[model samples]
Target: MNNRSQISHGDKSRNTRLGRLRDLVPVTSAIVGIDLADAKQMVVVCDHDSRVLARKTFRVRAWDLGAALDWAGQKAATAGFAGVTVACEPTGHRWRILGQLAAERDMAFVCVQPLISAWARRGEDLTTDKTDEKDAVIIARLTAQLRCYVPEVVDETWGRLRHLGARRERLVVELTAQVQQMRDLLECVWPAALTAANYPFRSTTWAATMTVILDRDGGDFTRTKRLGLDRLENLVRKEVIRWGAEKPGLRITRNLFAALDDRAGVIAHRRGALERVEFLLADWLETRRRRLEVEQRMVAVLDGLELTELVTSIPGLSAIGAATILAETGDPHRFSSARALVKHAGLAPRERSSGTFVGRTKVTGQGRPGLRLAAWRGIWGTLRVNPVHAARYTHLTTRGHNRLKPTQAQAAVAAALLRQLHAVIVTGRSWDPDVATFGSRRRPVEVAA
Candidate 1:
């Protein structure tokens, strides 16, 4: 045993208590705690009294974890221990593989919070020095004290949906940045073009018009003077005619001609700076198109899952949004209550009260940020469209006590929506907008009469 794991000469009283604890605990139970990492893990096995029986560091591989468990169990068995529970700090997805192995081997497994593990490691000892071996032993002792919970694993479809949703979000951001870049380039080259049409980078109707400008045979728009204005105009006219004659979506192409024809002459000479603007602009459009395809796939996947109809029945919640909620939240069965679900998304109101001073309630914002953002989007959409949630928003604003600010109002509505969704999830009932009941009920505050 390491000196750290031993009761020191100064701690004789604690040593007596440890002996009592060791006697009280059944000889059958053992705890195997692991300090998880991306590349390797430090493991410690301890029987009832926080006494380290075995400690080892091994590369993070399935076989290594399996062999470590077997070796630890044998070590415990020699010490008259039978039952074993494996645990580790929740270190992102690093623990998943170990958890899965434990599950497969029929061993109990749990995850302790990193904060709790850290505090446990330094409690009273003020042990400034730290190592994987020490942390692993600490985790084992804490786990034996029942200081951990099981981590929930999401379903395969939900996992895919989450990745797709994340990708779509990134693509949307990229598209927005690209559009802004295109607008800036056009503003420099042709100020009148964007002035004619506020959102030219929308890439539906204006795409055809942009194609005409880009299809010029000469290197850049500066060559338009060399090609003569008539030839350039003729090229644009022919492209517009082709769009009208050949393309399926050209019905909207007609609107682009006037903007292009009017603004074409604004940039008399080309900077040659934005030669690939049209191509890059079209690439952004293509990214948006891919995002739509992903949304469609998400809808298809969500349609097959339970509680999806329940989720989508809420006003302003689309099937995609519903899928995002389910995916980001994992299985709702893991949450003990609707409030737990709300807290999981960090939507629960946090209290900030000190002596003689009280701070306004604010959402904790401590959980899954993506889930909170998804709920926020739903709240925004609901405020715009859903009468039930809108009324709830109105109620929140009109509350006699500390009426909510606009931002607070949004957070309140989002929390309410999250709770409603949670209720629908747990109760396995579809959201009924026509028979709105969840967020629609609030009694007026009684005032001095």
Candidate 2:
């Protein structure tokens, strides 16, 4: 009998529960499951009846990775497995190497999410006994039961770009903090410097100018016939006038300048540091711009393949938002309907009930944060340009649905947009704004007394 035809009802039920777990899992004579750790790993092989065939624990090293793969291959061969399915817990970065090894050996591997393992352990009777060996058995059982979805292997390019984007965001945040700190320092000495000079200390040109000011001696500014004094005064006067410095402000500014002049080297050093930060920021921005271009091109290709035109047609969803929805969710077929998409987006409300103690409805927020944010941003944009959305927003507020404020209204709009996006992708048709009723007003129902 063919392999497909030979699958039993028990196998069918397992497959149904896990959604394609059986197809992904090899129906072998033995299944080897490995639980990865920092120093060592525990491995267990189980049979069709979930009986442990063999088990071992080995240290992980450069040599051990190869040995582990070789050992697993030999065990499968000895056990007469037509094929083997290897299961492992992806602990830290240690499991990454094992995953790569599994791929090289052409063996199916199921990665157990850390959260699932923690939750499983919480429910166990022997919770106090937490060992590498015991955890390995739990991992094997979890894999045998197919308790989690297989994580998609991110492409090299996407992974690299994502890292770059993350680094860029971090640097931007750091730069902002540094700029704010510099502003605060300047405010302490030269509150009027900010008001009078109107030049941001964070800017390159202004930093250079501040360096010049900080280097000057108070005696030089007070000198009557000196050229340096004349030049310094002229610069200060120009800045003061530009910044709209009053007579009283000028006195305060000059006092601060005089005090800062006492510690000229400190201010000069800060100026140099600020200049370096600016240079680094420029380089990072240029690099990010290039990477962004590549990401945009990649998104365009994927968007075309996935029929994301209708999603992009929604008022607030730009290319990035549409691409994010496509990349994160993959094909919408996994979602049975638009309602599934809404729940997945976390736009749907949660309900609580206990006999007569009905709890207040609240957003579950149990979906992708990135998708939720994209939807929120899109809705906000739509409300601004689309009069229909704005009117609906007003209606929701006036009707005591204040909890469903403008932001909530936007989420609802985004949910509606997803429905259109799903239809366009499934039906292979362009989005019809009229048919979508994206911003249309709902007719009020008449009450029968």
Candidate 3:
């Protein structure tokens, strides 16, 4: 096993020691922790030593926010603090407005992980009682100990892309559910219809044939038979051509006849079933159209952003995929290093082990799920065509020891892709295959003699 996979007690101790030595926030700074909620927020102010100086609750509004911060600033000034550090748990979208306001006012806005705050609350108090006031104090104490990080506040372009990407994800999920529901309906009403193509919905030709059967003929395969193979083929061909799909093949027409001949005839309530299918088809089509529009908007937004062309220089990665990944990541230069970028995507490898028993290693999954998904999908296309990713994946899965499963290997490749994307964007350099897979089984570069 790789030494990194095994976490020993000494490692934990060393990490704790290092964390204690690091002074993330100045001791003279005042920490303002706000327990955020939808309508109102509970705020707490503490000095460097975690002494509660004041506490207040304010409604989440423009004037209210100003008053709350102004009150905290007054308290800090009275206590002779050097500066104010605003800290909060990422409570939904409530923190962004506060963080932005704090930024505008030149206050250091930092974030504490929810899990860390929760643990900190329980570790010392040993109580199950939880309240907003208590949580705000905990946040302030954590901030005092430098257990918070500066939150990333993306600018306008990235904000738009993130929203678009989220919308696209929802549309895709709805489209998938619609497709599955339609498939189930087909299975019940017309069993043989599914046999026409491997992925009927994905193929426009198959979709055209199904549309005619469902809409015009009222899900009546027998009417298609009465029309005979020649006329049936002509009708399907015309429909396919109208939809800009491929011409119907002889096998496709034959399959329709074969469906009619099958022992399992049309199920009862076939007309009602076809009507539902048509409704679902219409909805699915609309969702697909919306998704395409979102993708086009993403491309346009990407074109306006810097470093897009450099990121897209990787072989086989589409502009849409790059856009989604970039939107999720925001500004790559903000990340301290490529590994930090991978960790932000939740692709960081984690291990669980005891004194004698070794456990399976897996990803931390502690960061943005959307970013992880986009990175995985973004790198998927490059696995076959991109030499660097292909070689890295091969070496990871086929190595002598510590061989990873296909899924694990794919995730590793995705993390590497994220790291490479970050490196390229930060350095303002195009992707180089050799630089990506430095020690892998790449062919040696040749020079003319």
Indicate which candidate wins on TM-score.
Answer: 3
Candidate 1 lDDT at 48 equals 61
Error of 3 at 299 (Å): 1.3
Summing lDDT over every window of 10 consecutive residues in candidate 1, give the lowest-scoring window.
Answer: 243-252
lDDT tens per residue, model 1, 23-51:
33334678888887766778888976789
Model 3 CA lDDT for position 386: 95
Q: 1-449, model 3: which lDDT tens digit per residue? A: 35786987657655764464244356777889898887788888898677889888887763358678888989988889877888889877767878877877888787899999978978857676689998998898888776777677688988899899999989989988999998888788777778877767777666666666666667566777677877766777887775456676557656755676664535676778878887887687678778999999999998897656987898978889988898888888877678778888999988789999889889999789999999989877999799878988998899998888899999999998898888788888888877787723377689999
How many Å off is the CA of 249 in candidate 3?
A: 5.5
Task: Report, for every candidate in turn, its global Cα lDDT versus the true structure.
Answer: 0.70, 0.60, 0.80
| TM-score against native, each model | 0.77, 0.62, 0.86
Model 3 reaches what TM-score against the true structure?
A: 0.86
For candidate 2, write residues 26-117 as lDDT tens digits: 46635677777667777887765566767878876523676776776677677877767777776666666776777888877678877788
On lDDT, the stronger of 1 and 3 is: 3
| Model 2 CA RMSD to the hidden true structure, in angstroms | 9.4
- lDDT score of residue 135 within candidate 3: 90
Deviation from native of the Cα of residue 176 in model 1, angstroms: 3.4
Which parts of model 3 are misplaced by more than 4 Å? Answer: 1-24, 60-63, 222-254, 261-266, 306-308, 351-359, 439-449
Ranking by TM-score: 3, 1, 2
Cα misplacement distance, residue 271 of candidate 2 (Å):
9.0
Predicted structure 2: lDDT: 0.60
